[model samples]
Target chain A: MNYLHKELYNLLISDHHIFDFIRESALDGLWYWDVENPENEWMDGKFWTTLGYDPEQMPHKSSAWQDIIHQDDLKVALENFKKHCEDPNHPYDQIVRYKHKNGHTIWVRCRGMAIRDHNGKAIRLLGAHNEVSALKKHEEILKRCNSAASIGYWEIDFISEKVLWSTLTKEILEVERDFTPTINETLAFFSEGKSKTSLLNAYQNAISKGESYELELPISISKEKTKWVKIVGIPQITANKCTQIYGTVQDIDLRKTNELKLREEREKLRISEESFRANFEHAAIGMAILNEKGQWLKVNNKLCEIVGYSQEELRQLTFQDITFPADLDADLVLFQELMDGKRDHYQMEKRYFHKDGHIIYIILAVSIVRNNEGKILYVVSQIIDISELKEAKNKIHSLLKTSQEQNNRLKNFAHIVSHNLRSHSSNIGFMIDLLTNENEKLTEKEEYKLLKTASNNLAQTIQHLNEVAMIQTTLEENLQAISLSNSIKSAIENVAAIADAAQVKIINEIKPDEVILGLPAYIDSIVLNLLTNGIKYRSENVDSYIKISSFHSMQYKVILFEDNGKGIDLEQYGSQLFGMYKTFHRHPEARGIGLFITKSQIEALGGRIEVESEVNKGSKFKIYLKNEKDKKPMYHR
Target chain B: MKKTKSLCIIDDDPIYTFGLKKIIEFGKFDVETIFYENGKEAYENLSQVISDGESLPDLILLDINMPIWNGWKFLDEFTKLLSEPSVVVYIISSSIDPKDREKATEYQIINSFIVKPVSIDKIREILQSN
Candidate 1:
C-alpha cells in the first residue's frame, strides 16, 4: 500500500541512480508497494525467479509475499515494515527467508525506503532484494577456519574511526565474546613500552603510507599473562592514501621459545670449539690430530718441535712414515686396533725417527674421535718425549752389572785365603806335636809324618783354591741349551758310585725334552751336589729315595730335587744354608761346599736355587732356570 | 768295653796315616789297621772286601780334600755298603777349617771327628770307649 507513493521515490532515485547501485551488484529483484492500496504491488521477473517460481505464476501483491515467506521470517518482516511506516524518515531493512516453489527456504536481504509527503506519514516503499545465503555460508566457513588455527584478523577504518576484530582476536585478548574494542583499546593490548612504540609506528605507517608490516612481538593478554604473537598488516589504499588496514594475528609462544633455546645451544657449541682450539695450540706437550689415513690433519707447535719438522712438512707425512723401523710394526698394530673399534684408546713407549735421524723415545697416547652419527672420524695423539730418561736408565743398568761382578770376585778371593790358611796352620800344629811329644821319642817316623802331611796339605789346598776360582769366574764357562733330564742323568752317573755306596735310590722324573739355557758343567755340578746331600743325610730308619722332577712357571724352568732323608731344619739355617763351610747337620761328609758351590753355579747361570725342609720330613731343593728362547738372557730376581 | 778287631785309614797323606797307625799301636789297643791313600782306592778295596765275603772293619778313619773322590763322595758310596756291617766311621783330617769340622757331622755312621796329629791319649780313649 505504501509503495503506491513509490512514484514519488522514483522521481528522486531515478536521477540519483540509487536503483542502479543495487541493480549492479546485490540486487536480485525489485519491488514497489502502495501503502494506501495494499493489493497494488509491482514485482520484477527476478523476484519470482529468485524463489524458483515462474514470473507468470508468481503473485504481485504484498499478501502473496506474506503467504510465501517462511513462518520464521514472516513475523519479523511484518514488524519491520510496520515500524518503518510509522516514521517514514527511518529506512527499511530486513533479512528474511521465503519459501521457494521447490519447498526450500532461501535467505533474502530486503532493503527499502518509505517515501512520505511533508506530513511525515508513510506513503510508498521502494526496495531491492538479494539472495544472501551463499555469501553467509562463505563467512561462516572463514570464521571456522580462523578459530581452528588460532588465527585472528583485525581491520581499522581510517575515515569511519572504526576497528573490527575476528572472533579469535577477542579470545586471544581474553575479552568477552560480544566486547567491541575501540581503536585505543586494541592498541593498549600491546605492552606499554617498546611493544607499544613499534606497534603504533607500524599501524600509522600502514594507514598513512599504505606500507605493509609483519612482526612477531609480545603482547599483554591479561594482568599476569603475556603471549608472543605474529602480526601481518596489509594496507588498502584509495586515491593514493591508505583508507583501511587489515592483518592476520597468530599466537607463536611455543615456536618462538623453542627457536630461542635452539639458538642458545648453537652458541654454546661455538664457545666449546673456541676453547678446544686454544688448548690445542698452547699445549706444553706434543699433540696432533690425525685423519683416518693417519695423515697429520693438524699438529701443535710442540709436536712440530719434537719431530724436528715444520708444520707444513709434518702434514705431508703419515704417522708410520716417521716412526722408527724397529718400533713401527708394534705401533701400527695398536693404531689399527683403534680404527677397527676393537679398542677405544691405547698408549705405548715407542721410538720415532726425528728429522735429524736420531731416535726420540716417546710415550704416545692415542684416543678415538667419532661424529655425531657415531661414525669414526679421526684420532688425537699426544706424545711425551722421554729420550733423556731412557738414557739415564741404561747407564744405571750397566753400573749395577759391574758392581755385582766385583762383589762375586771379592767373595771368591776370601774363601780361597781362608782355605789356604787353614791347611798351613794344620800342618804346623802337627809338626809341633811331632817334635815335642811326651809319649814317644822324636824319631824318623814322626819327622817323616810331619813332612809328608805338610806337603800333601799344601798341594790339596792349591787344588781346592783352583776349583773355587774356576767356579767363581762363571764368565769363563760355556753356556748352551742343555736338556735338563740329560744333564741330571749324567750327573747321577758321575755320583753313581757314591749313590750306590749309600744305597741311594734316585728317581729321575725330569721330562727328557725340557731344555734350558745353562752351563753344562754347572748343571752337572749342581745336580751332583744335591744328590750327594740327599745320600749323606739319610735317616738310618728310612729307605731313602731321591726324587728329581721338572716343573715350570711363566718365566722359569724348575727342577725339584726331593729326598726322604734326615732333613735339616731349614728355618733355623735358612740364612747360612748356602754359605761356604756352614753345615747344618751332624754328618762327616757335610763339608758344606757342595751346596755353596751349587748355589754359586746356579746364580752365575742366571738361575736360582731354593730349599724347603723339615727336621724329620725331607728336603726339597728347587732350581729355577730362565727359559730364554728369544736369546735374551734373564737373571734371577 | 769291647776290643776293636780292625781299623781303616782313608787318607791321601801317607805320613798322616802313619802317625795315626803308630798311635793306635802305641796305645796297646790291639787293633789291625788298613790304609788307602785316597777315597777312590778305599771305596774300591772295601767293595772288593765285601764281595770276597770278608768282614768289614769295625772302625774307619777318613780324610777330606782327597783326589779321585773326596771324603764326601766316598761317604756317599761307602754308607750304602755299611748297612749290613756295623762300621763306626771317624773323620780325621789335618785341615782345621770349620767347614771340615761341620761337614763331618752329616754322616750318622761317622762316630767321631778328630783333627790332625791324633794323640796317643785320644787313641786310647777311643779304644776304651768302644
Candidate 2:
C-alpha cells in the first residue's frame, strides 16, 4: 500500500508538471462543466483569464457563463455546447465575444469535449478557451482595407463545385448576399465575346492545373452597363490535387478606359505625321527647312534643282552663302520678325546664287514653325523661279521706249511735210491773185517769164518731194556688204563734170580693201549729196577742195567727207541740218532737201551721219556703217 | 462795206506777210495794217495797246506754228484784253494734223479754222460777213 501511494504521488507530480508547462506556454486554457448538476460548472484559472475574468470571480454555472457572452452569440454558443454534450464523439468549436470585469469585450475561441460514463452518456464537459483578440482585430483591419480598395475575395470548392463569395465580392458584382452563382454564371457576368472567353479560359486553367492567373477583363454587372475588373486567382492544392481557387477581383474600369483613349490618340498622331511628310517631300515648288541659324536642315529635290546643288551639299551651307548680297538684308529683317513671334510668314522678291555662278531671281515665301509654347523651331521656305518673268518685263520696257521714239519721229515728219507743201501752194495762190488783179496791164514777155518761173518752181518742188518719199520707202531692206572704195570713186566720177567746171579738187583717202554693210542706193545717195553740196556751196574766193576718208571701227566702218567751201553757221543750222526745205544759203540750187535725203537714207540702213562745220571753214560729214566682209565690187561708169 | 478799223497779220512766213500787205494796199482797203512775225510779238503789242486804252484790232489773220508763243497761246492772252471791239479771228494753219484741227474747233472765240493758202474769194467772204 505504501509503494502504491508513492507511485500515485509520482503520477500526480508528472501531471502537475504537464499543467505547469501548458500554463507557461499560454497555449490554451482548460475548463470543466457538470452537465448533471447545472450549478457546479467551473472554469480553470487560465480559462477565466482567457475570457478576461479572474478565476476567483469566475462564473459558477453554464447560465453564469452564458450571461457574460455577447447577446447575439449566446444562443449559437449554447446550442453548439448542447450538441457536443449529447454526442460524446463530437467536439464543439465556436468564436464568441464576452464582457470582461473591466467593462471591455474580448474575443475567445471555445472548444469543448464531453466526458462520458460507461454507457456513453456524458456526465461532464471539458473545454478550452483560447483568447483570439489580436487575431480578431487583425481580421477586422483586413476586411476594412479590402472594402476601401474595392477589392473582393472569392473561393471555389473543387469537390462540391460550389462557389463561396465574401460580402465585398457580392458588392463588386452589384448583387445581393444571397445570390449564389456557378462558375459558368460568374463567367457570364463578365462582358460577352473576347473578355468572357479570356476569363473563362483563365478560370479553367487555374482549376485544372492549379495555376495562378491575373487578368483584367470587362464585366457586365446588369443589362445596361459594363465595367472593367482585374482578377487574380491562386489555386489551393492538397496532395497534388486542386481543392479550391482563391482570388481577388478589383474594379479597374476608369484606368482601362483612359489607356484605350490614349492609344487611339497616338494612332491619329502617327497618321497626321505621315501625311505631312508626304506633302513636304513631293511638293512641286522648291521647299527647304532651315534652322534658326539659317542653316539648311532639310532640302527637297525641287530645291536642289533650283539652287543647282545636291541635297547633301545644301545641308552643309547656310542661307547666307546662297543669298544674293542685295536681298540679304531684307530677308534677315523678315526672319528676325518671325523669330520674335511677331509674324508667322513672310514673302519677298529675292535673289539666290546658282551653282553656276549666276543670279536666280525668285519669289520666296517663308513660314516659321513653332511649338505649342510659341518657341520657333525652324523655317519652311517655298521658292518660285521668276527670272524669266523679269526678263520678259525688261524686253517689254525697251519695246515701249522704241515705239515712243518712233511716234515722235512720225509727228515731226508730218509737221515738216505740212509746212513745205503749204508754203508752195500759198506761193501759187499769191501768183494767181497777182495775175488776176493785173490781167489788163501785163506785157507778154513779162507774163511769160513769170509763168515760166512759176511752172519751173512747181516742178522742182514736186521732184524734191518725190525724192524724199523714195528715200524713206526704198531702204527698208537690210544692208549687205558693199565696196567702200568703189562707191566713193563712182560718186566722184558722177560729179566730175561739175567739179571740173568749178575747178574743184577731190582728195580721196579711202582704203581700197575696206568694206561695209549698207544699202547700195543709200551709200550712193549719201556720197552724191555730200559731193554736190560741197560743190554748190564752194567759196567765191577759193577753188573747191574735198577730202574723202574711210576707216574701220570696232563695230562700224566709218567714212568722212570734208570740204573747204563756204561753210555756214553750224549753231543756226545744226538742229535743222537734216530738216526738209531748210535752206541756209541763198544759192539757186540750195533746195535744202539734199542733206535731209542723205540723212534719211543713212538712218534706214542703221547708220548715223554727223556734221561739223565753221563759217567759211570746211564742213565734215562723218558716216558710220556696220562692218562686214570685205568685198571687191565692179565700178560703174 | 465798212472797212476794218485795224487789221493784224500774225505769221511766221515773210512771203505770206508781204503778199497780204500788197493785197491790202492794192485793194485800197480802208484799214491800217499791223504785222507781227510771231504770236509773242503780236500779244505784246496788242496788250500794250489795250493798256493804253487803244482800240483792239478788228480782224486778226493768225498762223498756227511760230517760234515763240504759237497762235493758240496768242488767242489765250488776247481774249483777256479790256478793250471792247468787234474782232474776227481766222486761224490759217499749214498743219494737216487732224488733232490740230480738232483742237482749234474746241475754242469758242475762233471764228474759222481754215487750211493754208487763203483764197481771195474766202477773204472777201470773211470781210463782207464782218
Q: Highest TM-score: which candidate? A: 2
lDDT of the candidates, in the order given: 0.80, 0.81
Candidate 2: tens digits of C-alpha lDDT, residues A324-411: 9989999999989988888999999999999999988999999998889888888999988888898899999999999889867765
Q: Residue A593 CA error for candidate 2 (Å)?
A: 30
* Index of the highest-DockQ prediction: 2
lDDT over C-alpha atoms for residue A241 of model 1: 82
**Global local distance difference test of model 2:** 0.81
